[model samples]
Target: MFSFCWPALLFLPLAAFPQNAAPDAAGGHSFSNPATAICAAWAGPATDGEKMRRFLEALTLDAYVSARHGGTGFNWRDITSLLARVERICTAEPARSLAEVWQERKTAWHRGSWKANTVRCREILAAGDCNEDAFFFGIWLYAYDQAKDGRSEATLQTLPQGGGAMVWEECERTPDARLLDVLRRMQGK
Candidate 1:
């Protein structure tokens, strides 16, 4: 009954949303070929005009993680966000390979350059649907907290339960609080 979708698909109409333009569902990271865009089918005056096609052959060749009906249970938003970034980069530098640009800006263009802030998290909770964005944000929070505490990785023991319910309960308790603050409190940090 539910479907997986990003916040108004920030990727498709990426130009419309510039950096620091209101907190929306956002995250960024890198993987696969080093090029900014692993496989860019550039076709016209505008890099994103019609006829541009991205085939799965490249994806299948260098597939990282796959998405399932229940979602990948990973910080996929960051990865997806990174691809979106690479796309933008590739558009500007069409001559570069997806891997080439990706390697160049992997660290510089890491996640948080365009992250989904706490306000957006609250809005996602208010909507009453634990979509991928909401769910991944929760996982993102848990992992983020783990990293902040100097933990090498987020283990099952430390990961909070209740998924979207947990986020909803926490966000509702502190309507104006930042998502990281809530996460810290939940983890007793």
Candidate 2:
């Protein structure tokens, strides 16, 4: 005995409905501020790989989502390139912060001027390296068919078992493929 009016749900505002909220990442750290003094720590030796990866993923993910929701007018195509450019900026001026460099690039570069790097496969998939969390974070980014309000989330319970291994196997065969494309195909999109 179950009954409900499907038409009633359509009138509800997106905010009014419950969403599959993600738990606050990184000890409730608010990475909303771009000038949060991250380049120094990121460039320095990483003592705790997990924490470092979490923070990095969170920061970049925030930026990506912000751009997605019109926070930034032009969204950067992918995390790998965005991070690569951020790394370049960090290397050139260790004192400058992420948001500063991000803003600079926003003004300087065209939206589609650049392409995602293929060699990034090796870097993104290499776990236990200094930049270990990129793979999981990257997966989370593409986990949804549409990244909005966490409606279609890709969680551990939702993903098929051995999915990660399948990605690794595919990546091993095609080292030059786009990470997002690879992930999408593996997800059977």
Candidate 3:
């Protein structure tokens, strides 16, 4: 018979590894919320904070599209709240500041000031030096220009929703099996 418990000893440590993983570290894990848990697992060091920020950007744009074209099915209040949730999960200083600015823009939009939204987006773009920030600015600019030409309504209705649903789906589509597995596990739980 076996004289040693080597197999059991080896398995014990491996089982403990998951629980011991760090948060925000390289290859670390986080679970800000169930929804964000999926993002955290799906968002590894490579994607981490920045990609998550982009996902928020997508959600913001989706809300705008829904509000403008979904026959008012969406609300700016909901969009601002969603952005705030994303900002909290992202936990990056820049994201926090962006969230505040976004909230202000949402307030302005509610007050019927589209120019305020445009200005806020421009300010965010100016403060950052990356595609993610630029993307939101571009999206807002596209909306602004289209609104000016009275074509945004048609575009908004045609656009698909991009909040939680879109981000999670895209995360699942990522090539990394580990990230995919983590997201799957979170979704199942």
Candidate 4:
């Protein structure tokens, strides 16, 4: 006769599961939204030009997804325009750093309560205004949501892009004041 340990069997499922499943390494759980994750990384202190480019690529995909989903209250055209402005900033003279831009924006957001930030994001989303400030704030809100959901670093390296050269070309053609300000700050001007 064989004896089975019932108590040990109860612990089997727990042992099989990851104790702290890392979102970024989830093999099969495709991120529901990658733009937010990329944006979180972009806002962090470690970002560089290459990281900015990657974040832009992920944002483009998110814009497409917003267009396809149709009920998320997202205006895809506005999102595209917003991304273009960000790209322009990245390609500017001296190249604005996303980390710096995020710090500035985060500081501004923190001047008010979280409720105020939420209200501002809602207003921007509802107004459908595509100005640089509004667009940046809106995307920042998305990134904030992703961070809150513990998906900040989940899809940084997995998002797809058509190519980097074309993005750079378009970025060279666009211009933004906020980005210019960052460049100025970096130059001590």
Worst 10 residues of 3 by lDDT: 1-10
lDDT per residue as tens, model 2, 1-189: 112121222222323211323224442222322325334323432344334343344334444444344432222334445555666666667555555555555432223322222234554445322232443334344432233334332122234445555656676787677665776677666
1-189: candidate 3 lDDT, tens digit per residue: 012121122222222212221365576453222112323332323244344334434333433433443211223335445554545544433223332333333432433222223233233223333333233333343333344334433222222333223323333454332322322343352
| Candidate 4 wrong stretches, greater than 4 Å | 1-109, 112-117, 120-122, 125-127, 154-189
Prediction RMSDs, each to the true structure: 14.0, 14.7, 19.3, 21.4
In candidate 3, the residue pairs with backbone N, CA or C atoms under 3 Å apart (3 or more residues apart, or in different chains) clash, namely none
Candidate 3 similarity to native, TM-score: 0.23
lDDT for position 171 in model 4: 28
Off by over 4 Å in 3: 1-105, 108-129, 154-189
lDDT for model 3 comes to 0.34
**Which candidate, 1 or 2, would have the higher lDDT against the true structure?**
2
Please give the lDDT score for candidate 1: 0.39
Count of steric clashes across candidates, in order: 10, 0, 0, 0
Residue pairs with backbone overlap in model 1: 33-99, 34-99, 34-100, 35-98, 35-99, 35-100, 35-102, 36-98, 36-102, 37-98
Q: What overall lDDT goes with each candidate model?
A: 0.39, 0.41, 0.34, 0.32
By TM-score rank, best first, the candidates go 1, 2, 4, 3
